[model samples]
Target: MERIEGSGASQLVQLIRAIGYNSEITFELATVTSAPPQLKIKVDHMNVELEKDDLIVAQSLTKHMRKVNLNVKKKASISSTSIDSLYTLTLPQGSGEWSLLSFGLNSADFKVEEAELEFTDELKKDDRVIVVGMNEGQTYIILDRVVMY
Candidate 1:
């Protein structure tokens, strides 16, 4: 047979190398200099202006009070026979149909919660966010806001 090198082995090597090429994934800290849906964000310490068209903002940042559908369970024990029913027992939070089911006297009970908060007026200038660079920085996805409270 003919030699492999003289055939297409050189071109084959290039294709193999490209296959192993990792996607440029980077996490960058950015500040919103203008409101989102058209965020004029500036990369912290870098002269990079993230384009709005190439961004994927989280729904919570765009929508006004997106309901958080998180699955959380809490247990509360009652040691009295008089407490047959629960009433006006304050939960952590909620907006959806939550449940506080009782098992038995010695088994205790559980709680599920949910909530939604308005955010249409939330994201604004000077708000910091986490931006992820994909496709060699040609596209950026805004993960979420960086907050401490």
Candidate 2:
């Protein structure tokens, strides 16, 4: 069993985190007669096999992949109001309706205006929706919007 260390291990951890898996990792080595040796990593809900060639390049790439910050400001002309309390809602694409899934409230159908939708093609099942309220009994779905900077 060859020990994987240094940047190789760091890149492996980063890849695991990128896939949204935050749990203990376990590594095991087993000999195979027909195939070349490879690293087998398993975590809850995920399984990965990494060969020696991929691991070498991944180590260098991971070192340079660091987070950077940017300043974001909303356009002045777009009038907006503060949301008192926001809740995340999820609706299946093309369903044409939404049902509130929290606070013991009855599920009701809500409509989303086409102009409010942003990145409609990238939506997935149960994707997050921002819920904003104008006042009690008045709520709106803050769909993805296209704004020109």
Candidate 3:
């Protein structure tokens, strides 16, 4: 009976150890509000991959356009590793109104190798899309963490 209890306790401990903890992050934009754009803009969702072309919507602003900033905050129980050295952000162009934003997180240490905002008219028909990515040889980025606004 004692051995059975000990075995149960060990299994319980093992289960707890196997369960790794996950962090919850709240994304906050420092410059841009989450509110809908004042002007009509197409917001398309796409993943940011290296050397890949993505489609997104374009928004024409009747008012002055402001820079969009992203800020991540960790919950009290969690902490974030420093991303200062690791991550790149890119903007890709897509169809009429839809544009793409790409994020490249360094696989080695999370440093950003390429970050760009772009617009192209070559991929689809008449879509005004924006695409972003790293150069060819800089494929050492791994996207493990992400948040949507």
Candidate 4:
């Protein structure tokens, strides 16, 4: 599988976190029957086409992300501390914040930042970084790979 490194992995993780953690969220691999074949995500009751540029990026990211173990021994509970439109992931080491913007699935975007330097999945705790994706009856959680450090 292709491996995402450096800023690319960080950016992809941010995007996944921006999607938020929802068990009901699902997606499917679809081929657009257009002039040129394209990939699309059938999610959230919508058929959203992936932008050409984004598709290339997603393909690379997904390749690497799929190889990582996304399963957590314990699930982290999601909570909101403020009325703002953002979700926070509180871990034993520290906390990170992310905001989500949804326009169907194609226009979905997320803003995230690198958390405390000590944050990592190797730390035995439930508050590890996770990005969930569902399809049919299957669910997946992509874990953050420590590629930089």
Candidate 5:
């Protein structure tokens, strides 16, 4: 394929790309909201209506390889007075404490166990993502994470 320069070239490139890949499969711009397994995406400029559970992710796109913000303050509990358990203060960030020692009591109320670790980072609202799906209403796979500048 010949490389062309400038804004016109980009669209041409996308068109040419379709020739190599199946034309039935097309790239689309979508907005992500909510969370995984129930992710809500709004496709731009298409009549096709998408819904929850309609999208599956490409594992590579969901890779934890990228460094991300750890998590901001929320309802967390204090685990101990010592520095060792200070990190757990951000675990649930609430007053779910239960310590007889009184000094080491800021922990989740015995309910937020291992489930907290299962939390997946969700794309912020209005973040744009690319999806490749068949026009025949097939399940769309998120190509990768994208941010609209």
Candidate 6:
């Protein structure tokens, strides 16, 4: 059997319809900038009180007050199996108007699919770098092959 000299092994090449072979083309994309969602926490009642940690702040529409306290409690604690294990803020009224402001991740299971991997980070410890996939019973993270500086 005769072999071609100076030729590499039989390789599979991905080709585009109009574009020819993409062997020498490499993508060096610039960094990506993402802005987090703007979340507003407003108490629907005048007598509503809000507390993040040990400090407490009151919200009163009658008093024309509309600013939330910026102090956050800092502590180390293990996460609970139930979502309620994290701190639950008390709304003035409602069965449980408290939404999960942040979640802590004790452990995570990850998988790469189509060169994408998704994950979640515990806000308190992970500098909010944890990733999360938002789907009912499908909370998984999907990270793209792209990298950010």
CA RMSD of all predictions: 15.3, 25.2, 27.1, 23.8, 12.6, 25.2
List, residue by residue over 1-149, the lDDT tens digit for candidate 2. 24445454344444545565533432212111112233222122225432333221122212133334433343222223554555655667865655433342234333333333222233222222222222331222222212222
**Cand. 3 Cα-lDDT:** 0.28
Report the alpha-carbon TM-score of model 3 versus the true structure: 0.13
State every prediction's TM-score relative to the real structure: 0.46, 0.15, 0.13, 0.17, 0.46, 0.15
Local accuracy of candidate 1 as per-residue lDDT tens digits, 66-149: 556544345455455565665454456664454454444444455445767466655788987877778988788887777633
Candidate 4 lDDT over 20-44, as tens digits, reads 6454763222332222133232222
Number of the top lDDT candidate: 1
Q: Predict model 6's lDDT versus the native.
A: 0.27
RMSD of 4: 23.8
Q: lDDT of each structure?
A: 0.65, 0.31, 0.28, 0.35, 0.59, 0.27
Any runs in candidate 2 off by more than 4 Å, and if so which?
1-122, 145-149
Ranking by lDDT: 1, 5, 4, 2, 3, 6
Error of 6 at 85 (Å): 22
State the displacement of the C-alpha of residue 72, model 6, in Å, after optimal TM-score superposition: 31
Model 1 / residue 58 / CA error / Å: 0.9
Candidate 4 has its poorest 10 consecutive residues by lDDT at 119-128
Alpha-carbon lDDT of model 4:
0.35
Error of 2 at 89 (Å): 64
lDDT of 3 by residue, 4-108 (tens): 233443344334434632222111111111222321112223232222222122333112344444333332232355545544344456333433333443332
Model 5 TM-score relative to the real fold: 0.46
Off by over 4 Å in 1: 1-23, 64-121
Better of 3 and 5 by lDDT: 5
